[model samples]
Target: MFALNRKNSTFNFKKADFPKLYDLLSKVDWSEMTNVKEVNAACDFFYNTLECIFEACVPKTSISKISRRSYPVWFDSTIINCLKHKARVLKKFRMYQCQRHLDEFKKLRSQAKFLIAKGYSEYVKSMEDTISHDPRKFWTFIQTKRGKSRIPGTIFVNGEAISDPCIIVNNFADYFKSVYTVSLDNNYSANMTTNNNILLPKISEDDILRQLREL
Candidate 1:
């Protein structure tokens, strides 16, 4: 694999960079670039100059690997604070054996639960209106709310257990293919309509026609 040759150049926009950026942009002469090539060069120059000015004005930090914890979408600062308060209450209750601390913890816990449930309900309700117009988006929203699926790490294939991702994927693909595929035999296909006594649900054609006409 070819390693990236590009340097990691990252800068955060600060209030101090505003005047420098404005000054850099104000010096541009757009009228001089008459041809496409000149225009392209001018555009590149403007972008590069802007970047230089931004780099000079703002402090750049070296990219470092950082560990982050992923939380649910409904988890905001309010929920975090609520959880922290509950934890503190629990700790105090345990330390002092105080009934009030326990009661406070229970109250906070109930409030947090209600808030989480309400958040999820609102989240789901928000998608209801989109179901008719954008079903794909609606289902995507539902799946996101449901979070990740917990498929078993190991699956049986041809009487043997397999856990490798590629093998499991291929096994599932093969199973689905076999289940959905229709096998055809020339003799049976040629005499397809010969079976006169096939069980099918009886329905009134006139009723169907009436419904269609109404539609």
Candidate 2:
């Protein structure tokens, strides 16, 4: 029911079908990720099958150090790249930082109050008020000026610039019969696999698994 991936759906690879594509990926034997892989495989299949699905390729979390180092080439590549340049409807990307950044983010809020009021400003905000006064002290090794690749400069949310960028995505795909949700709100809202339904997309849990089984 949640229409999140509906544009830029096709791929130009030799084997574009998800089932076939997954078979090729199975050769890699990625360790201890059977369950995760199953999900990814099913999702891949859904993307391939859904001719109307629109999705974007984005950078994986920096936490996945091995994958980042190993597959530098695959960073921005997706199962389906939008060669057609379809209009992408993305919920503005966000990042949730440590508590130390809250005051700074608040300062930024004051600084950006006028801009924050605008729809086009895309202001970043902190998730909490409780943290150490020294924002940089919170992040031990990752420093603002130590030449980190991803984070270019400090952008205050509330008043602090979070150490990293994370985001929430919504798109519609046609072949997906059931719904799965991704949250675009408070970082501390709840664990991703929560018991409640409202924060997530509308879909029966059984239907969700059934769609997975399809892959």
Candidate 3:
């Protein structure tokens, strides 16, 4: 929390100010801080919130399918909708993006061992930390196909889109395996249109850009 201010060859308050600074500022009108802090807080929440969500919503067996297909749709849709109001605030604060803080949220997933849980806490924590620190080779959200039991998907650098027809069938085919030979497209199309603005069919536009940058 300390950084040199080149302008004055001195310390800057943003980093230098800590406990006392926060206490003093506590008296000021921080009504806007709620809106302001959420700028990147949404992204941070996405990283952390989704961990528990995946564990609870997705079974261990089906996670892989969800990760490869349905997850992108669910994750993006969940995040975008959950943070719709925050996105607006972020837009307003474009001039003052706290890249450092925003960047920190980007690492929350890697720290999932402590933040999240599984049967194996230690090993998963180590792996999660490593992955969270690096996005190019790590993806925060992941899942397997939906099923009775399973942790289907593990986060990775990349995977199949949630809406892919191939993914749909591979994951959910069993449910319809006996019903019909209908294409997974029917499901994909229906889900996509239904979730539109509320939930995305894939990862965020920003993550795509970051991935592109790495390439």
Which of the numbered candidates is closest to the native, going by highest lDDT? 1
What's the TM-score of every candidate structure? 0.47, 0.13, 0.14
Residue range 141-166, candidate 3, lDDT tens digits: 22222332232343222574455445
Model 3 vs. true fold: TM: 0.14
Stretches of model 3 off by over 4 angstroms after superposition: 1-96, 113-146, 149-215
lDDT (10s digit) by residue, model 2, range 1-215: 23334253334434345564455555544443445557877665554543332222221122222232232121233311221111121111114444544555454445443432431222111201111243333242234325364344344445754444431111112224246566676654665456454465678867755664453
Please give the lDDT score for candidate 1.
Answer: 0.70
Ranking by TM-score: 1, 3, 2
The better-scoring model by lDDT among 1 and 3 is 1
The lowest-lDDT stretch of 10 consecutive residues in candidate 1 is: 1-10
Where is the poorest 10-residue window by lDDT in model 2?
A: 83-92
79-121, model 1: which lDDT tens digit per residue? 7678778989999999999999999999999999988788777
Predicted structure with the largest TM-score when compared to the true one: 1
